[model samples]
Target: MNRYDNERLSAIAVLESLRAGVPTRASTKALPDLRPNLLEIFKEDLKIFAGGQNLPGKFVWGKYGQGKTHVLASIEHLALDMGFAVSRVSLSREVSCHNLFHFYSKVAVPLRTPNSTVFGLQRLINQKTEYELLNSPIQNEGRYVHPLPALIFEDYFRTEGEEQDTLYGYLMGNPPSDFKSLHKKARGEKPILKLERKFKPSEHATAF
Candidate 1:
């Protein structure tokens, strides 16, 4: 009777066809139309950024069910052929115990570090904020410190099920460190975790 019900009916029709092994009408994807041109643009833009020409990132965004995910999958497929760093996240598992920490090894009975009790996480990777690096003994004890790289966040607007809102909050609220810079990326009035980087990159990068 209403739009929501109609949407449900349409989805059911799609499912019914799949279940019955009936073929639905097929159409060409935008990926075949635009991937090469987009990849070339990204490569040129990345070169400019790497060379310190003050460029922006290359991200793609599209409306829901518009095959954006499929396009991203195609990109990942290309990445594999080209040997690029790639990963896909399942927002459905944001709070799973397995994601928290899997490798377990108890640090003998005497966990001697004094500040260890203060921090919640057991495993500590040294992180270097600009201030810490300048002031601390890090120069004396040389070590690279960081979080995951080029964090890829997909499905920002997924409506998966009961856990959907929770997972969305996790994504919008506490983004991984690499994207801490984009932390200010928010929805309406809610303020999300953001990075200290200047607005230069976010300003120029075009998504969609």
Candidate 2:
């Protein structure tokens, strides 16, 4: 289709979503912000975070039908388009923010990057070499609460096919009982557990 045709289709899609009482990333982009001040503040906060500064995060509060979710959806899309990795989850009976490890599993598995609709970091992981993987900041202790994810990340690089997928799944929060066998096949050296600190879910959720 022509450029104009594509734009028209996208506009139609945005309108359809809005008509259904849901605003998506396309809808956010097409419509003018109802609360520019709030959005601008968030954009600035994102900029600060991107500059290597940590933020405690911001809270957006509004009564029902006030578009709080819409604003957050917009920010999620904006951050992804800016080349940032974004994971979004809503709290429910099954997924509560109070449980750190469970919450991490929910968010980590749905990881999204700028260009792909598929979740997880498989493509990015495959692009790196062993040297790059080992030297990356994640391998350093004190950066995160635990070094287990970093070790699994390195293991992810050493295996391929189903074994690689298993390790990747572990990194995404689904640990398999037979993972040690896979690691042995890939590295043929010391056990992976021996190479890193023991992971305690209570104390190590932050690492992933």
lDDT of each: 0.36, 0.82
**What are the clashing pairs of model 2?**
none
- Candidate 1: tens digits of C-alpha lDDT, residues 1-208: 4556765676667566545644222111211445577666655655565465776445687788665655655554444344333344433444332423210111112222323433222132222222343454333322312111111122222223433333333332323442332333322224553434432323312110
TM-score of 2: 0.86
In model 2, where is the ten-residue run with the lowest total lDDT?
189-198
TM-score of each: 0.27, 0.86
lDDT leader: 2
Candidate 2, residues 77-153: lDDT per residue as tens digits?
A: 88987789999887798988787878877888888988887887888778788788667888777787787777777
Clashing pairs in 1: 180-195, 183-194
Q: Could you say which candidate leads in TM-score?
A: 2
Error of 1 at 20 (Å): 14
Compared with the true structure, the alpha-carbon lDDT of candidate 1 equals: 0.36
